[model samples]
Target: MGRQRTVNDHGFWHSPLLQQCTTEDKTALLYLLTSPVSNVIGAYPLVPRIAAAEVGWSKDQWLQVIERLRAEDLVWFDPERMFVWVRIWWFHNLASQTMGPKLRTRTLENIRRLPEPWLAPFLADYKARLNEEQRELLNTLLAGEFSENDASVPHGYRIDASSNFSLYNNNANAKPNSNVTPTLEAQAQVPVDKSGIPPESHAQVEAAIANAQRKGIVKADTQAIIAAVAKQYQAGRPPRDAGAYTYSIAQNLASVATEPSPPAPPSESELTAWADLCFCWPTDNPSSFIRVDKAGFCEQVTIENGNARHGYMPLGPSKLLVALREGRLRKISAADFEDLAKGSRP
Candidate 1:
């Protein structure tokens, strides 16, 4: 289900930032704020093309709004990733008035999917601005898990600016005051602590990761899969099941085979020459496996599991010298040698 977002009628109209933008700019900003695609944690994938289509703006017009908003420090955009983040997204939503971590997790899922550089700004904003209750919600978002005990978990909201900063729901159209007001609850740290972990669990988890490395898994790529599970464990999300839970996470890594590097594409001259020599190549263009026979006929051959059919063997540029050293081709006529060098055997 899409998350229910609320906008305050009084607060938004009162906002100086909203007042300064042009009619077109304000509409674009509103669209971005209320976009279904935006995650509550604020960072969202949005390109000029998407914004233009969604907000009824031309390409040039949408870009101008981006430049203006960015100048005001209201939004940050990554052209390379086509991702944009709203600077104050969390501050406005702290009035969610909902209980438990589930609400926070909805937004955090999007944040978790972000790279550090993208998530850092929002996190920094939260750190500098959130009150005690809001901080726990932030922690829950970062933790990516729930407390089994509702009593120990905090129900969250921020105080108005007089207390710290003005807390308002930054929605675009909705006006209903929620049945609940976001607030703070005081409680003990509830999840079973690290003491519940078995003594040998750390060793087992490390060994699992090391074994994966030996099998050629890129440590960097799998870091997310590893860090998330570990963070949850440390936060007391599942203490007694530490070994089994983490092992299950690593098991996923074990199942995936390392992807091989893609072969370099053949250049235009090489392709033309190969076509002239009547050699077949991969239509998808990943790699060409070519073979030469004793008859001085050159053709591209496909091999599977280190074996070939019809007496053809694996022979590419890499294997050419090896084939010669192995005496696979002991004699070559002058004409055949010339044809081979020219890649045009008659």
Candidate 2:
């Protein structure tokens, strides 16, 4: 009795298509072709460790081979997330050959008749290489098999071959509003603290500003900090309120200071003044006044001429308050102030 062959055995030995490939290429090709059927998605089955083990190579050696494959366009690797996708040229060639000359001819002919101009070049090139019978079959297949009118083509009919053409046009004609306002709830949830500062977000802003200073990219100042925060808000950072901005600045500053080459430090007077402002004035009580000392303590004071009226204001307890004052907390609008005051205890 003749030996009964399993699909895997048949695919491995008797597949005429596999005969053309070298042993290593054949293994790689089989791995790729089976991957989709094996339910692999995104980067696929060739993770770094698995790829190394499968190929019986060191991690570094496997990486180099992967790089070479990528450079040849035979494989794709996304290093950031460590994923891979492979394209098996041999499989594509095998499939094309298996369709036979007659079917190829019919598919070409029908592609030529497609009303779309983009398909024209492909049809013309195909027809030039194929025999008359093959061309006829190719056209018939394209028209009857892959045609939008074909019930088998899923969704029944497709007038356009490329989905992107309409997508581009739709996007071009779309209008985006430039001045959309946030809803009250969204605004309220945006990290506005009682003192009108954001909570728990000082680190980011400080880091950004400090980075700019260290790189000699920009000078650190109230305006510079605000500008940095504004840029972040525009770029979709959350908690788009004053307090978050203040916290971000502080965070950024601390981060930049940690680098090997720290930027020049602020003068003693400047530091003292900043400490005073952040601690003296309460963000929640914008109406309340404060005084600051060089030693970083706050003294209560009355506001006069929009400034502390009493003797040199003592430094405050809250470092955040000082940073806020340095950040130049703007006077809240009358309506905003009224809202804030209503929430305050008398």
Query: Lowest-scoring 10 consecutive residues by lDDT in candidate 1?
Result: 157-166
Candidate 1 per-residue lDDT, tens place, 26-130, comes to: 676677778878766667787777778887767767766666565444566666667777653543555233223565556556756665454443444444344
lDDT of each: 0.46, 0.39
lDDT of 1: 0.46
Runs in model 2 lying further than 4 Å from the true structure:
1-26, 35-45, 89-346
Best by lDDT: 1
Model 2 residue 222 lDDT score: 38
TM-scores of the candidates are 0.38, 0.20
Candidate 1 positional error at 226, Å: 43
**Count of clashing residue pairs in every prediction:** 3, 53
Q: Give the true-structure RMSD of model 1.
A: 20.3
How many pairs in model 2 have backbone atoms within 3 A of each other, for residues 3 or more apart or on separate chains, i.e. clashes? Answer: 53
Which parts of model 1 have CA positions greater than 4 angstroms off? 1-3, 95-99, 133-346
lDDT of 2 by residue, 136-189 (tens): 665666664454433133221111111111111112333432233221122233
